[model samples]
Target: MCGLRKVTLREPYPDSRPKMRGTVTGGADAPVRACDVRFGSADRPQFRLKTIQESALAGAFGQTVLKQGIEIRDGQGRPMDGSSSPTVAALRAKCADGPAVFIAEDRDPNSKHTFVRQIFASYVEAEAERLDCEPLHFRMATRM
Candidate 1:
């Protein structure tokens, strides 16, 4: 019932000109190109666990285990625990084996539900895969 979708984050400027390909030097008023931004909900265990009750993947592996935020396990399926606040570096160290599943909360503050956003095959490609759904890629623009 779940599907992947493409999302774009844009930074708008009323007074800016588009830049040509390979033209590094442009007028100061040139519109800045956007940068791609990618991340998974499971990137932060605390937040993931905090919002677990409101997630659809509640019955994914084990409800009890998931409720406790122990989705990242070892080869034998033992929960890995450390800091309540985990960083990208911490996740990379824990997910050294392969992809890991984590639910991502929707950006909409008013939404009452969250979905399984990404399945990371590795730390480098944080949003590489998905669970019971299609893959989604997001293009985000930033100011230069």
Candidate 2:
């Protein structure tokens, strides 16, 4: 038995990653997301309660559609004028060329407002860092 070695049930393999990782991305096309990572247990229960409330409201025809309720703001905390093309063009340049933060004039205007706030948040956050996530990469690259 001098040459024999025993393996235990809980021995972790050297190449295996732990259950948690330091960095993750919330890619739109992937099921794994940054929401799966967070600062605390804060959002989980709040989300469950919100889901229950939304479920109840669903039967009551839900809330009215938000029109003209969203405001776009800048780094100085002032509202951006959506009607000004020149101002928007400047924002596009400042946003590190992330997804068009504007409701593109060429794309259909329907339902796109639903995503406007979130897109701008990512746009601004990336702008501050001067980077964005793409696939497995943390750097921006020229489109193929």
Candidate 3:
């Protein structure tokens, strides 16, 4: 089982202090006060896609067509594309009719999976049923 505990410490050093209000694993942790350190996975050599047996690039992470051949556009009437992450309110305000695909995209440059692309492409392919029209990714894969 896992639980979170509140930890408050008083230190006479800085004007601002940080409390260790995080998950407890019953392990020793460095006493941090007003420390601005963010933990993240180390930059690993871009993993191999071959391991997953998938390689489909979005020649451009922009734009999808509706069933009626209408291109998905942002509130500005611009064709939705690029690494843009729009909010639900934005979509609701723009797409008044229907079929407002959220288009979840993970712009993580290190991850080795094209899961986002797969979802977007598969959805577009299934809904639009237009193979030739499915948009492509803008970036190129690593050189062989």
Give a tens-digit lDDT track for model 3, residues 5-81: 12121132123332222222333221111111111433431211100001122222123411222234434545543
Model 3, residue pairs in steric clash: 58-136, 58-137, 58-138, 59-136, 59-137, 59-138, 60-136, 60-137, 60-138, 62-81
Who is ahead in lDDT, 2 or 3? 3
Clashes of 1: 1
Measured by TM-score, how close is model 2 to the native structure?
0.22
Tens-place lDDT digits, model 1, residues 17-78 = 32212221343222221111223332322212111121223224343333332234434544
lDDT per residue, candidate 2, 119-138, as tens digits?
22333333334333221111
Cα error, residue 37 of model 1, in Å, equals 6.8
> How well does each candidate superpose onto the true structure, as a TM-score?
0.21, 0.22, 0.21
The C-alpha RMSD in Å for every predicted model, in order, reads 16.6, 19.4, 19.6
Question: Top TM-score: which candidate number?
Answer: 2
**Local distance difference test values of all predictions, in order:** 0.24, 0.23, 0.24
